[model samples]
Target: MAVVLLLVSPASQALDKARMDAAVKAHLALFSTDDIVEERFAQRASAVDLDGDGVEEILFMATARCVGANFDCPNELVVLAATAGAPGQAGKRLEPDVLAAAQTGYGLAGSEQIPGEVQAVRVLKGTIEIAFLAQQDSPVCKRSFSTDQGRQATTHCPAPGRHTWTYRWSRGKLTKVSS
Candidate 1:
């Protein structure tokens, strides 16, 4: 009898280096090398200009075995922002409210559960339109707010299982605008 075992390769599932490098250099120059790690190989980076700033940010997703002590696991989405000028310039980390919304619904201070995902971010005439998937598996949780108004919104889905929340800059402070 003959038996064969198939092994999947992690490198084959890694984010794209060209794209990751570009994004890291563009917006995340502040992060130290210890804070960032290129997982899989180079096949997990999707580039897009979220703010329409002409710079391509990277959306990296990958699954790998845990190799470090800092994190509990390796199944996580590594979101990156790419800014114009300079390489290795670290982008800003998402605020707690935004992170909370992305993970759950009902904003940061609420106790409601909504499944969702952040689809896209667009800036037009000083206002930022955060397009995302919201509760009940709807594809139209289109929320808009002024980046200068200090209000932010959070998004959650009900069926598809995706979440994303955004915090806006207003009056020199970041605030939550969505519930």
Candidate 2:
């Protein structure tokens, strides 16, 4: 659990809470409430100089619940980023392309391109290092969606290797590093 507190502004108190709420909501939107384990998502966050402008950016990740008969959910790895701001503005989502990258199975060790699971997030040397685990034996990120008209199901094949990949912050985005 990362507790981030930087040189906060007077309005930062409200801004931080608002950003956290938005992140949680974004995570919730990834899956149906019944499939989401509300307790898995926490308010823990990381504050760092993601852009190196003398201000700290807020970062967090959310996980989905694999409940009942479902193997996995889109709730696996959702990372949110927010910049410093006053009252009603400044906190914004920094990563949506991550989902696309994961869906394509970008940096897997084998043919399984499904992205890996986030195991840890640490800020070191002024950079955010996110470690992902390819838990081959466990359920990966198989996302299902339900809409007003109907529902869609996608099953990501299980990975063959229990390997790992580390993605680092590059220009405000998580770029998967070669393992």
Candidate 3:
């Protein structure tokens, strides 16, 4: 899947909770799924001025069923921009193109669980920081089974590596400051 996310500012705006709630409900309505509920994603929503434009953007993480036996759920970080409609009319929901598709959950990779998860997402200075644990290969261990007459078993134990994707808005476009 082509996944992307956008964000800005550590100092999030104190948006109208009622308005944000309504926006979240409206946004969730786009997906017709009996299994998904508004409250499930609402609590994770926030408002940030990603472009420094007076208007704020909605940031939320969408999650689904577990991706691994350990119940590691996958998350899609979504950013919704408010679009102005006819004068005096409510703005339309516009999902702005995001900067990166950083991994945010664990998955099975050839019998080994690849470590991945979003540790934290925060705005620092004028940029957004998405801290996560990404997948990386571990050293394979070869064990000799004495009871099995020299039979050997290979095992892999990987430690998730920490990573951060930093982004900022410049010239009406989202730019990757670092990763």
- Please provide, for model 1 over 1-179, each residue's C-alpha lDDT reduced to its tens digit, 9 standing for 90 to 100: 99999765642323356545543333332222333333332223454443444443344433332233232223223445322243222585765434432332111111111123445544433233344455442323323223576645433223444444444433322333453
Q: How do all models score by TM-score?
A: 0.27, 0.46, 0.49
Summarize candidate 2's per-residue lDDT along 1-179 as a digit string, tens digits.
99987675643433345554544555445434563343445323554555555444455554544555345543333344442323222464435543432322112111112345666666765445556665544444545556577767655543544445445555556655644
Q: Best by lDDT, which number?
A: 3
Ranking by TM-score: 3, 2, 1
Q: TM-score of the candidate numbered 3? A: 0.49
Mind giving the per-residue lDDT tens digits that candidate 3 earns over 1-179? 99788665535535676666566555544433333221223336677776776666666655443311222233445565654333222464434311011111111111111234657878755576767675542211112223446655433322447877776654444556776
Q: Which candidate is the best by TM-score?
A: 3
C-alpha RMSD of candidate 3? 14.4
Report clash pairs, candidate 3.
10-123
Question: Who is ahead in lDDT, 1 or 3?
Answer: 3
Per-prediction tally of clashes: 27, 3, 1
Span of 10 residues, lowest total lDDT, candidate 1? 105-114
- Global CA lDDT computed for model 2: 0.46
Error of 3 at 101 (Å): 24
Q: RMSDs, each prediction?
A: 17.1, 11.6, 14.4
